[model samples]
Target chain A: MITATPRKDLLLMGIFTLAVLTMPIWLAPIGASYPDLLQRFAIFGIFAIGFNILFGLTGYLSFGHAAFLGVGSYTAVWSFKLLSMSVVPAVIFGVITSGLFAVVIGYISLRRSGIYFSILTLAFAQMSYNLAYSVLTPITNGETGLQLSLNDPRALDSLVGVTPTSGIPPTNFFGIEMSGYSGFYFCAILMIIGFYISMRIFRSPFGMMLRAVKSNSNRMSYTGLNMRPYTLTAFVISGMYAGLAGSLMAVTDPLAGAERMQWTASGEVVLMTILGGVGTLIGPVIGAGVIKYFENIFSAINENVLHGIFDFLPEILQDGAVAVLSLFVGEGWHLTLGMLFMLIVVFLPGGMVEGFTRIYSRIRNKNNKNNGEAGSVGSAEVQPGE
Target chain B: MGILEVRDVNKSFGGLKALNKVELDVEEGSVHAIIGPNGAGKSTFLNCLVGLLIPDSGSVNFNGNSLLGIKPHEINQAGVSRVFQTPEIFSDLSLLDNVVIPTLASRDGAFKLNGWKRADQDSEIIVRAEHMLEDVGLIDKRNMHAGSLSRGDKRRLELAMCLVQNPKLLLLDEPTAGMSRADTNNTIDLLKRIGERGITKVIIEHDMHVVFSLADKVSVMAQGTVIAEGSPEGIKGDPRVQEAYLGGAHL
Candidate 1:
């Protein structure tokens, strides 16, 4: 019982699929054709989408989502180490493991709300981070991360009699190597499935209930809907999404680090969700891409690239221009991101999606005026014709 | 026995007792209004019954089920709905959504997981919610964000949200606290119509006109105690009830 008609949903999904499939071609002109950045975009997009379900809908500001991501990474990396090098087992293992982890964390943290719940989650995440960095070093392999060793017998791979081309076993789907375009495609497909499921949840009864919880937990309870199960369900689902994203990261680059469990990593996804649009379906994904884009491209913009862009100008003027702009890009990309975040928060509290919709409605209104129609742009709140 | 029974309920905040040895028996299918001056603890007593607060020692039974120490949603599932003093509706959601959420909750039980199912396609709840909105006279503004609604409209929307549940007991705290004479009369009319459904109601109101007009049974609370209990006419005529109202009742 999705809110949108099946036809509309299918059409939207088709457009999304086409865009993702042709990313290599479409993104090439922008110099983002590389598989690594693209895979990262898909992976973090999935992460932020899941985070949005819990934060955007339920209003539970979990300060420890990265614990689940770290758990998923460790689980997948462990699967690669112990089981076969096939990503199938790794993904399955990761998602399930993180979901269980979320159940425990959610159950405890949900006992309280507001900043108290946040502190509880932060405590749990900090505990995990500390354990992973120290006592659980054997399991997480400490700061160096759990990496695949060349000497260890991959029992499932050996027993299944699959031979690798190199000494360092490459993760694969049967014989197809999970590297380069193939790996990006695999992650991209998962990202689409993740997006579809997120859209379904957003349109579902559960999603409404979650939003109700956000609006008024006490009211929802008085309405005879226990918000605990709804919040917990949302939390677990989002945790698994984070887990899937982590597993995808492992699928592309086979390593798990303790730093992935840090509160800062959890904060990063929150930033991405808020920066795009908190509750909107596509906002978090777009936000993730924007953040990732800044992290990669903006940081890669060295003095040389700045100089090249200003090469037409005099040499002294080029140097001065590069110095002035350098604060926003290159090693200071985070400063640009922080400024952008502030601007969005102040001017567009609804985030980037709201900005786009606002612009879109303005265009539509102008077109309507051109066509000489009655101006029914009544409410300040944006509601599309639908 | 009454549908909702409260016995020997006592609640204290630090040293101050909000509800002290309070007792109430609300007849089934009747409007029971509890009137009190400021701080008469009418809200506190209601909170105890609705699981918002746990009393030091008391028994609150609704339909033979003990409601004490239970969750608010559990109490709601046990056939009790409450309208807040200031109309606690989902301001972010549309008016239709605000009503449908409760309708779904009432039909689906306290904690059923329906995350994957589409909400708008559920014609049964949607239709019921629509009709409920019409009942409250907010059908035209159904798609509007509830936050944008006027104060009176917000109260009506909240009423629609509660009425859609069709509960055995509807607890209202000052349903007409701050409204025009017309709005107050409209709310009184709405409650009277709801009364025809034979749904038991426990209303805590300060407005004597509303209390006397709607209440089948009236109880006057003062200083955290039920000082007088009788028919509306009898309670109105009581001299001590007049004193309680005029001389700093400290409800």
Candidate 2:
């Protein structure tokens, strides 16, 4: 059997890139808000990709990755306040801070594996959220969260001679306009790059070793391989991806909050990974888009919207149906998400990609059986067993 | 001088003395077989040699380098490769990939940045892995997943993985533990071929047939200490070995 080639992977990636670039345009006829929805999809897709590298390939399920994302956002905001208002420096600082945070947390948390590892990471993330909200009020601005203020001085603003009416500077990509359509495109490009990098890592030898470690750590150790360094490397790389996603988020909105570091947010990415397909390249993206779509679009559907759809039904059935269905949609959308996650885990343990591959293989197996039967009948005169 | 020299190695777990003042000398290019009953510290002894467990007191020297306090991976880097009782091949990886792992690790010293390079493009490493696979008669199943292989094939694959590292000394824990008669014979042949390659091998086995067929010198242990050391015929006639195996009536 021929193995998958890089060229084939590149072709698939090219198709995905084209699809992502044209999605807003394709969905524009439906609503003017499709672009904003697509932008959120791309950002979360980046976040999920990073999370997958840590949990999916390495088999180390981190439940505190959102902490790193929060750190990235805070770092970006700090950079904006202290240094230039340019998104470049802010993003770079954000990524670096996330890596630093990962190094510290990984050193301690990697001491344990399996569920304990997950708990340790979750605890650490909660601790980070607590600190950001309480202890680090000077930096994080406490529960109110950090937002761009008019009183804050931008030292670079005077050098560039761009005097703003309010001290709060608008988001810009190294002097280039990063607002409206361009900002969304910028985030889309970053997500595509992040996806490409993750794909490269998944196909790399280091990725193979990570998979091997996940399959059997004892075996890899006996082969004279120290698993710690490889694991730490995967963790840091994944953290960097999270940092990138967080930096993009800060750039998009120019605000940072402690809520982003919550353990629930970390668990959300895990949910996304499992819902889409954990090990598959594009599964996490699909998972992220689906969840984000539900969060943004589906959650907006209230009892009125439900009634609008069920208007053609009998009046008695419509009123009762809308009331009951309303409980499962909109603000109750998380209930739907939780149910979908459970179903995916129960029926499709390998996630959505495996489900798709299973169908593909079933068809292939059927065709092969048919060919075998035809060949057997054709050779019946020569040899009965053949 | 011996290639591997262990001096006054002692190990204990809780109140149990697993190994007490044990000394071993493995000459270069010689097959050394270690035989013992259950819980006789044979596995513990092997673990100590490979740095899995540090001896309370003693020094293990390989090629004049002290192995004390070295990690297992470092010990492997020092040209000593080990195979566990169970086939320790990376089950999820292809058989060829399993061999390639150690080949790359051995060349680059455990962790390296050569991950991004294509396996086929690493012609030297690929050639070495292929040759080792061919030697173990697993070239045909190189693309098969290690987990799907039969017990015998898995053992052969593990052997191939170790051989690819070009280790100075091979430490095997029950190399033929769960093999059929045909597989046992194939393993013996492979061991003979490996012996001819001039790498010293230390094997822990329960099978007397394997010990008699392949071992140049046998050291039998009882209760964490060497009870008898001699040739196969010498060991067979020894009263101590007979008593260890059969409750002293045969002795």
Candidate 3:
């Protein structure tokens, strides 16, 4: 019902591209312009966008999506170790491997619905995490996780004579080093592409089918529509998005860790999607940015940093303020996050996007009243004509 | 054999036999009505036909093809569409979508990976769905949310959805369970229009006016067993059918 026409589609794409590309400049005011944090914004934004495809569109709340992220990271690291230093192959490997992983898990997990479906996915993720931690240690490298090794046989790199430039090889795009500002740009480009694909999915017929599955699956089945494959396709696509995000992380850092598949990481993406607006196109990415920003700021705020700001107050009051507030900052950032999430859930069930829409509509209504159109046209008011 | 045949169907829940030795033969292009009191197993019988329930020992055949132990979607793909007692249309979707879903399924088979095209932009589906809405006299309400429609309109919208599939056998469970007199007569008129399309229908209803008005044949049931089967006039005059309605007290 909220589908965009082609003209609106292009306009939305243009606005999205402008906003993402100008992040370095716009984010400077918030002290979020550093390359590492900026890259996390793009990477996790992608993760949240993909998660929304299945959870928001189809209402299948998967608690195990991080398994795909873990798989993607491992695949990317392996590609760098065994094939070449180019991120292209690593990203490709990440998407393909994660897709295959999703196909298996989704097939088994989608057999159930509602809480059972969520638990099944969670069980699969936990299994993958445990396997990566211990059982599949040889291939996964166990607790240390996968990392690029210099002595490994990189057949493609050897054929291409792409030896290490310095003491350690940095991932590159056709020999261009993926570091600092350039790395940010590369990830930004990927994030834009990811957002574009998600936007298309939101407007496509397949997207409608997914929504139908969410609306009333029994009716969908009785309507001669089999919704199983539609949900599975959504699951795999979202999984590939998580994989792509994971691959980007490895491309930037060249390290794969088992913790990426942890339930906390999966929960974080769910939080991002729900906090930003579960079913809205831009909500999840915004949620990702907000959560990442708070995590960074809250973690950086030490007692001394708090005291520095509170210095304007009297000495006794400053000490008291820092002491009391310290529980929600620094290592206790999650407490603040928890409180914020609770508030959002209680006050804005439709998430931050709905909050914004309500505010915008209120403003427009006030403006219309000021312009004397309230008396001439009462279109905003619902009439009981029937 | 009729288009839809149910033979020796028996279903039980624990100690209660919900449907006991039920048999039905819905003929081609005929409007057959099943009238029974509450707990008469009319709904259970319909569920068995649509693969929502499996009878302990029975056979359901549609066009000579067995409809047993198959998935719900498979039953739909077998050219059988059911209208729920309570409208089961997608509440969150628009009326156009509610009407067009069956069209999409018919054109695309049971399942498809058609993610590229926009559903609204597809002229073929829109045309067909609009035509169905027109048939149900609901062409103007196409854009409204299905859930927001009135109770009577919800039934009409669901009917349009089922009819859009051009199902070989249309099975309706309590098609008009609660309605005002005007809405009931309006539904009767719509069914009369549908009857002209020559599609076989098996409807379960309690309204005698509706049964006497539309059904070519009527079946009366009580305690999960059919007691009488005949023309509307004959069923209305049957002593056993009267006994079933009056709970074995002579009327």
For DockQ, the strongest prediction is: 1
Poorest 10 consecutive residues by lDDT, candidate 3 chain B: B242-251
Clashes of each: 5, 0, 0
Off by over 4 Å in 2: A26-33, A165-167, A365-386, B249-251
Off by over 4 Å in 1: A1-5, A378-386, B247-251
lDDT of 3 by residue, A49-97 (tens): 9999999988999999999999999999999999998899999999999
Question: Can you list each candidate's DockQ?
Answer: 0.61, 0.42, 0.51
**Tens digits of per-residue lDDT for model 2 on B99-193?**
88888788777786444655545689889999999899899877777788899999999888888888999999999898888899999999998
For candidate 1, the docking band is medium
By descending DockQ, how would the candidates be arranged? 1, 3, 2
Worst 10 residues of 2 chain B by lDDT: B112-121
- Give the least accurate 10-residue stretch of model 3 chain A, judged by summed lDDT: A377-386
In CAPRI terms, model 3 is classed as: medium
Question: What are the runs in model 3 whose C-alpha is more than 4 Å off?
Answer: A1-3, A374-386, B248-251
lDDT order of candidates, top first: 1, 3, 2
Ten contiguous residues with the weakest lDDT in model 1 chain A: A377-386
Top candidate (lDDT): 1
True-vs-predicted CA distance for residue A44, candidate 1, Å: 0.7
